[model samples]
Target: MSESGKTNPMDEQTPDAVTEADILIGRIVDGEADEQDRTDFERLADADPLLWRAVATRHQDMASLCDEVDHEIAMATTLELPDFVAPRRAPRWAVALSGWAAVLILAVIWTTMPQSKGIEGLPPARPVQINPDDELTFEQHMQQYLLAPYVMGELDPIVFRVEELPDGRQAIHYVRRIEAFEFLDADEELPVNDKGHLTIDPSELHAPVGPASIAETVH
Candidate 1:
């Protein structure tokens, strides 16, 4: 198989040398051979009995390894495992008591600490003593009305009258109004004048006494 009259040493390779038949046999054993590779392997296997025996031996070895692995997995799963105990949780009442204890401790710490008198260069705050006989100023009355829990939205204060008292103090009379909306059925109609304005009766309405009154006297 050489250009010279003598035979080439490379052409007569040893049995250990890898050939195309060996590669095709390896592909077939590994299950990676396509239709063309399978056809080629079949042709090679028919030509050589040794190659066919090698592939059959490889398949038997693979099946035996798979069976051994499956047996190991089954034995591992069947072995007795240690019992797992979950951590116990505290009672609801105990948790609540601990929270209250923390709050009490914080309260004690806060109360025991020295209270600040006043900021530096600023005068100490004086305690205000309110007299029941004295009428509230306009600003004080407005502040009280605004801070009331029932008050909502903007306050529409209409000054009805302003007069000077005998004590040289001015008295202001005002009506505090609040606008609100209510959902009604389609058939329900509000009483409106010819001017297309809703009319409400003042006498039919009622409110809380003292600072919460709609109409109040402020000095």
Candidate 2:
């Protein structure tokens, strides 16, 4: 008798009741039973102790299999990896630029470094030419001098100018590099010629001049 005052359905059911109960028990043991399936199975097996023992046995068997597989994997050796090597080198211009940057760093360090007093028998330092009213320190002036080569258009990497065509495509204006020596001597309206070759222009050699600002004011 059930709590609903009706005879238990399983008590009057046919032999198919055992098969359906077995299927539901398999779903519960495999962890695949839905909420409704689990609820029905609990209610159906309320008076049956043998069905609970079967579920417990199935769970023990699965746990043993999992432990066995884990032990086998743990006993296996670690995988070996191959040695790696770099596969590319920098271009010539990039290498040259790197060398220039190294030189600039070394020059800056040498200029800003304090003289060591512990050294004996060193030659007297040469007098450096600098402006009386200029706000720049000696190290700053040295750095400016070292950077002048790039400022004077001697080490440009852009060998050509990119021009946009009327049809919305870009074209390269292949211009020759204006050597530092040539740029110091020639007088021209523009740096590039009609054929897109570079012509030395003396006027563009100097640093850009503007109205005095707070940066120029001495502390």
Candidate 3:
């Protein structure tokens, strides 16, 4: 097996010829050995106490290294930056003077600018008179009149009646009007059931429900 006459022990040992003790020791080191395997390894280690001490020291070193790595990671994640400095604010008089200065500059620019009349060789522009009534259609005027009461909160429009005109056009009319009750208590709240109906007694229709009653029922 060698150039010399003597044989080498490493040359005689093959990958397939690995001993069971080596396999047991490898499994224990890799944390893959079961209870029976660990027991067998313990017995083998008893034969060589130095080997057991070496393995134990290696395990302790690995655990310490893991803890150090974890500590480094935690420090990196929770790293903090220095506090930011606040900017100095200007005095009240300075701020007011700056505003006034800006206004004066704008005024001076506006006054210095020349007003445009008409382009050269073009006719002079005439002022166009617009009528307020001509701006809105007849339907828009009717809508404003119909919703005036509702907008004022005096009455709410309920029924809408649609009628066909003689010229085949349609006209809508708001028939019913009712006043909505305004609750005095701003903190008054009513709960609704699964069906979306208010969970209130018929006798307590006008009365406001307090938060204590609702909390009691909820608890």
Q: Estimated TM-score per prediction? A: 0.26, 0.26, 0.24
Question: Lowest summed-lDDT stretch of 10 residues in model 2?
Answer: 99-108
Q: Please, what are the lDDT tens digits per residue for candidate 3 over residues 1-219?
A: 211122334436763454455566567767999999989867766766555665665567778988899887875654433212111332221121111011100111222224311111212222334343343332232233223211111233323455566766554443222122212355656555889655643223343245345423432
What TM-score would you give candidate 2 relative to the actual structure? Answer: 0.26
Highest lDDT: give the candidate number: 1
lDDT of each: 0.43, 0.42, 0.40
lDDT of 1 at 21: 65
Decide which is better by TM-score, 1 or 3: 1
Give one digit per residue, the lDDT tens place, for model 1 in 1-219: 211122324436863455666567668878888999988877765766566777777678878998899787875654443212111342221121111011100111222224311111222122334453454432232333334323332333455666676766555543434332222345756556899645653222233335334322321
Candidate 3: list runs displaced more than 4 Å.
1-31, 76-219
How far off is model 3, as Cα RMSD? 29.6
Sort order, lDDT high to low: 1, 2, 3
Compute the lDDT of residue 64 as modeled in candidate 1.
Answer: 95
